[model samples]
Target: MKQRLNIASDTRINALLCSSAAVLLAACGAAGAASAQTTAHVYTMTGAASKDFALTGYDTNPLAGAGSLNGAIASAAAGAAGAQPRLLASVATANPSSSAVTTATTEVTQLYQSLLGRAPDAAGLAYWSQAVASGVPLSAVEAAIRSSAEYISLHNTAGSTVTVPATPYNYYVSPTGSDTAAGTKAAPFKTLARAAKAATRAGTTVWVAPGTYAGGIKTTYSGTSSARIYWVSTTKWGAKVVPPASSTNNNAWDNRGNYVSIIGFDVDGTNSGSGTKWTHGIYTGGSYGMIADNHIHNVAKSVACTSAGGSAIGVDSYYHGVMTDVIGNVVNDIGPAGCTYVQGIYFSTSGTIKNNLVYRVGAVAIHLWHDATNVIITNNTAAASNFGMVIGGGDFYHTSAGANNIFVANNIVYDNKYGISEQGVTGKQNVYKNNLIYKNTTYNTSLRNGLVATATVGSDPLFKGYSRTAAAPDFHLTTSSPAIGRGTATNAYPTDLDGKARNATTGYDIGAYQH
Candidate 1:
């Protein structure tokens, strides 16, 4: 337990009150020995549990102004002859506060001296007049200073609204010459490079309408703090967006440190089964980015960086400010056939990996790495992968702990090598609760190495019409399923797969789905 010093009892210094002058002297020294007041007994302050007397009853003394400077203000005002109150008020106004008030007063006085060529006496009437108009309140003067244009110019920021481009580049690349020369919907650019070149703002959204354009595209543009860069699909129909198989050229979607977002598109990696690849799809090393409502499937492999495989959605190498919203996306059958390590959707540090359906992932479905603290992994279903989900040491450099405060709840995980596994288990505080796990018999082969409730491990999750190849899987609970009304009483799930409300009065089922 911690210790502290507390007050015990009051040590009163009793003295005979002979006159009003003596009364004044006693009052000033009532708390402690001083010039005008009598010495009131004060006790030694000791240990935490002890109590000490707080001194009281010294207001009647007129000469008790010696202890503090504020008492002197009242004494000066009372003894003043005619205009002495005005003088006291001026002195009060001129003296600055302890922290910033002193500096402001000195600066204002120097400004007066700089103009009048002498210290302020009666000639400083303009300064006193300004203070009087300001209503003698310190707050008003502070507000006036803060509200100035000079202060705004020095301290204000443009932020996300002003710095980024207002309108995204709506360039459609088709067979009949791109939207370049004509610059209209009919006269579009031949390739994606022309559209990327015209991108000025950070989140300059470039909507690429469906139609196969030959060759590869490369862009080296960085967005600002307020703006970002985006490349998305414009067609209402389901189309595949892929790079040329024969070419070695690549496309770069670099966000630098700006907020970026990309929406709605699919890349065909197969290229009729020979296994072509692209550089990257919706890549970001910046912050405050979102990649949602898109279908990014295939791309030609990159020779420059062979290790960086084809990723459906990627958040490679970013830090604290990287707040991504990867939702409502459909990423299926990702990674090459023989690749050892592949990921369907990936993130680290403050990401919302929710409301997404991922299946047939070659390697790890949802991979989170590197000190990825406070990541909300909820309402996402994963199936048919070597591993359902894997979390590694996100903070490689920080010696204190790898990852802390990871909230993994209400996700439907099944049929993988491990339900969830952690390699660097040194100092990790992970919260795993209220999830539906089944079908593979054993939750994890290595029980001692993993950290999850043994009671939560069981058979098939019994999803409603849960198919492998359907456009969307139905995860609603059947009437006879054990998962119904089997959730924790305190942490009950609210909704099902189709966005319907669960049991409100009696509490609902477990996992992300409601019903």
Candidate 2:
């Protein structure tokens, strides 16, 4: 038995009526009908549910000149004589019952990949797919995924933890060792360069014993996300690295590895030659790296006719790397004669710079310049520098790619030429909150471009025993200090500079120490 569907005029008119009813149902109805109506409406409007379906047959069809189903639907609904159901049927066939399930699965997979950095598991895949099938829009699902805590923690680059393996592969370097020996505790390599070359794999650690090594150490090894490479000193400030006289652009250690950590070493650049050539104590690039618990000093370049010198600990990205963690380091005396452009911690991109002590620097202690964003500067103590902290591009160099979204909080700034200075284009939208700024020669806080302090105190933050002329200054706050229990409670560090809890019950104290 052969039954032909004569869908010339009457059938098309019936389909048009059905599509209009589906559109109305989609606007207001139960979940099941709404879901069906959504599909019908999309097919009726686009003549296909997906781009691949549209390109396959709709583009070549002679009746697809306008590329819209609106005219055909309207004509069919208006009882036009030449209307055809074959075109509408083609769109319906293109989006079969299986196609809806495939679309839902694809959407869920894409959302999981985008928001969680992984594919959805079976349970999650089924749940999101069912939600999409039950009349939840994909946009709403995406918004919910983005607002989740997991997504926030993953995307918060300044606060995310560095991935390190439980059992690390170990190598050793010593002053009185041979390069030909195995880099073990008993038979260690003589030079840092040799140890760095040997420590190539992820989770590999190069441990340097107490020694002064000469010549620049440049590492080009990379580590995986789950197992970061580490170069650590046997004792903090015990292993020292000094740049050689033959070094052209003097740098004690130049690291260009992703997920690599440089920890607990003394990097001295006292012998760097004078020139316009860049000089640094420890220069870093790549991304997701850490510079912690180190002592860096006396690295500076001679002032040029136009530009200034480099930094002591420079977190730069000449090749588009992003995000570093610079924490718990001591940087001091880092500038050449009359050089006003040097810095203790200089960053050009996103980073977390916290719990560091900077003193007697030629320029700003912490400088965020050129395209730096999403930086958190907290719990740091800076003194006897030209400026305590400077946020914004340098006006002299006219560094156009300035800073934005900089969070300057819970820091101690005192006895500098200027406490804090904000200048240039990126100075806008910076948050200066809960800082103890006092006793600078010029001003406590300087603001530009409608920048406002969240809750800043410009008075002396009565320390235990602090003096501008003291050999070693103590910055612990007294009980009667106004900074006690005066800071904004939210977003303060759990532990202060001395690893003490920030607050008992009342509130957080300002500056590097808790009262």
Candidate 3:
């Protein structure tokens, strides 16, 4: 028996109907120069005590002919079985959505919202987007969404009291304590490494005391989606991580733990010897990891201009399809004055990079290279860099190629040499819109080489104060700001960089600061 793919031409997704022409739907705002108009809602990761929908389904198996679907859109080749429908690309009949999303990302998001009643996380978006791009039928995708534990849990009316997850155990790390001691508040561990060793359980949080700590800390802990191992500084940006007196090539904090989080630490590397070079301030390669509320600065600043090449925050897309949340971090002063090699935040693959303030970095403030795909970059303020940001892959970087459902929205990319550039020839359906990309020396947007942005809010983001030196930069939106109430909630972060919620009175405001 052969499979028939029936993609209904009508927008109402009643049944899978057939069509002849190849309809290419963008995973992330793929088509139409439509204005962004997604309704703002608080993001939730509803599910069982075992897992959450936001981070689950990231590791879903790709459709069999996913590779074949790449480069050239092809119809889904069904198994030599019954009259089941073929899964031919994102052949979706548009669902009724408050959001005007018309791409693969939209389809997945609509399913998540309508079926599961929550926003699609980076991992879920990436996995399902790929599934859709690989020609998984919308009906089957809808079935999968309906069968998810999260969806089931949401719809469960069993009349039983749901058990809430308990808070995880806490470990302490301080310079005044000894590693030999138990990792308690009173008897805190001396080194972060010792705390890391002790915090092997799921959701075990390690709180570091205020003091300078030696760099090159590595975390190999593992945790579940419901119980991530959290490493937090007792004071925001107080527990500083500085490279050892004579370090080179190594990083400040190499976090490689699955479902781990590093929060509120100051990773400063400006003190490394002039001849020495540190790779990155905070590098997390693990899946479902969170690097937030931290200040990463001067990663390779002390190194010579010609030798400087590193990032303040580097989230390595090691596992290909995992989600890492890089949020609410301030990355600044990285690299020698004009080093093209250095960047503020560099990552690849699927994840959420939001509510971040990247200021005065050397080159591209934020970059996605090497296996780049399915990312949401929103609510970030990037300023005073050679390039505000660059999202592209393929031969330009070597060993990297992609651009699928890469969503960018509600950002303030300002005062850079060039604003929001793109590369790679194989890229497609990457959205760049509703951003305040203003006052750059050169082009505000240069995605012509890859894919062009649909629309850009070219108005000057009237911040409370603007400084190129990063000395006293204040990116708060004033009353008469052009960025006020202009942002779309599509892939938008609810919180600003200061850990404050967006203005409740007005709609979504662009940039890192809402109020």
How well is each residue in 244-274 modelled by candidate 3, as lDDT tens digits? Answer: 7666446888877898877788888877754
Ten residues in sequence with the least summed lDDT for candidate 1:
1-10
Candidate number with greatest TM-score: 3
Candidate 2 residues 89-195, lDDT tens each? 22221222556657888987877764554566564465446446644456534544443444443332221122222224667789999999998767889998898
Q: Write the per-residue lDDT of candidate 1 for residues 1-515, one digit (tens) a residue.
A: 11111111112222322122212222323122211122112112122223221112212232234442224333323433331111111212222234443444555445333322224333223332233232233332222223333222222221111111223233445555654464334565666657756655554555455676443454446565555565555542133455555645343243444465655545555453223345445555556676655555543232233455545566654434456767546666766543535567766555667655666666567777655555667656677656677766544433335545566655667766566665553234666666666653345423223465433535577778777666566656666555665554333223343444556565556554555
Global lDDT scores for all candidate models: 0.47, 0.65, 0.65
TM-score of candidate 3 against the unseen true structure: 0.65
Question: How well does candidate 3 score on lDDT at residue 390?
Answer: 88
Provide the RMSD of all predictions against the true structure, rounded to 1 decimal: 20.1, 19.4, 20.1
- Flag regions of model 2 displaced more than 4 Å: 1-165, 245-249, 271-278, 301-308, 394-401, 464-471, 478-481, 489-493, 504-506
Q: Report the alpha-carbon TM-score of model 1 versus the true structure.
A: 0.54
RMSD of model 1 against the true structure: 20.1
lDDT accuracy of residue 211 in candidate 3:
94
Q: Which structure is stronger by lDDT: 1 or 2?
A: 2
